[model samples]
Target: MIKVFYIEDNNGQYISADGSKRWTRLTGQALYDFLQTERGKKTHFFVDTDDNGVAIGVEIRNTELASNLKGDKNHSDYLKQVRDESGYITVSFDYFETEDGTSTGDEVIPNDEDSIENDVLRQFDLETLRRALDTLTEDEHALICALFLQDKPMTEREYAKSIGVPRTTLEHRKKLVLQKLIKFF
Candidate 1:
């Protein structure tokens, strides 16, 4: 069975259902509401679906806003251009298939050692890494230099005080920096 769940921005109402036919109508309404909210904005949605083409749930985003939040100008600019020219954007759902057509019923976890090694290898690309580092604000650079470069991973509170940014802001900046750095791998 496919399950569908969505929230309508206009009225802050949520709708959910199981089975293909029952969910179809709600899905249409949700899409219409999504488009309405996305007027003059670029958007994307992540849909979780079952093997039988039934959607399990959906998560939506303003693509431009998300890119800006990540401090990623390239993506934000592209999405902005697309939104300016197009009234609506179509999104495709991704489906993951099981080898034996059965749910594993277990969480997929990464090997920690391998992940660490990969992260280290990704840091070895000097030019790209330097460029990513350059994108950071001065305060962000100082904090990162103190942590990874200088071998000190300060707590969020300590890092924020040292960098002269709010703890939350510093946390967000660190996440964005790490995401950009990961692309080099």
Candidate 2:
């Protein structure tokens, strides 16, 4: 006996239970896999028989039936190679944090002054860096802030262009500022 699969009133389309996409794709792998699933097993398939009403073969609903509507006439069409559509295919990946993703006692970055008390050396170095930064000229200070301290710091080229300065000139000034800062260390 031969069986052909199809939904009663669908436009030859059977979507996945998630409704994110149509499960009746032309590729056989997905359809084959779906058939192996519980939902796929529950799908309705019709009998396709010879003129004598004798059984020939079985056609799965989400696979052969969908392929038929796609104009794939050859019975061996599923045997042909299919281009991978994994990029466009959407699969839900909302898994909870597994043991592999968990962090193991790493130092967390401090968010405020009180949090910095956890490390005395870091606190001292930060105070020294603040004093060094205070000695910068207004122009140099603005450049430093734009390049390094902003929440979304600008690139050197971008900051230079914004201040109407050549990149090389900005680099030279930055170098001089670093040299000045080194003296304060």
Candidate 3:
């Protein structure tokens, strides 16, 4: 069984654990050194005691949050007894199957065909959009850039006020420019 311990805040003494007829109290550098070990990584644990408040049992609880407190989710080799390997499966994948599947076909390696096609389509669409943007008039280009292409964009009212134009007129121009870009697409 894994060792467990709890802090005794009243005495300010690091009475680590006194369970199963074994008692250990540590403080200062000794406590720090003990924590550096594998078993002492967790800060809290459960300790059952008798009528005298003397520990007769120790418990180390396992939980997803507790296990991940040290950010050891990826590299941790502990907790193999209850571990389910299904966690390794990518949830974003379109399909999944157990190793003992009914299909007799040989295992196939994954290919990037879908990602490559998506990348090509994405690049083509960006190029088409750039070409469409190039056709806009100077004022339309400036308005579009202020609204959408900048690090920080301005609201329609803000852009309209900056250019000394009514919000309605600015909105109308934006709608027209978008319709033109759609037509180009």
Candidate 1: list runs displaced more than 4 Å: 1-128
Model 1 lDDT tens row, 40-130: 1344444444678787443445666544544554666578689879976533322333676564433344588889998877777766778
Query: lDDT tens digits, residues 1-185, model 2?
Result: 32334333234376656764443332345446766888667764433446876532233457667466445434333333232433343223334335786643333433676555657878788899899999999998888888888999999899989989899999999889989889877
Per-residue CA lDDT of model 3 for 1-185, tens digit only, reads: 22234443445434445533324455457656867977667554444435665543232346555445435533443433235554443232224455665543323454588779999999999999899999999999999999999999999999999999999999999999999889877
Assess candidate 2 and give its TM-score to the true structure.
Answer: 0.38
Q: Each model's number of backbone clashes?
A: 0, 4, 0
Candidate 3 lDDT at 178 equals: 91
Best by lDDT: 3
Ranking by TM-score: 3, 2, 1
What overall lDDT, based on C-alpha atoms, would model 1 receive against the true structure? 0.61
Best by TM-score: 3
Model 1 residue-pair collision total:
0
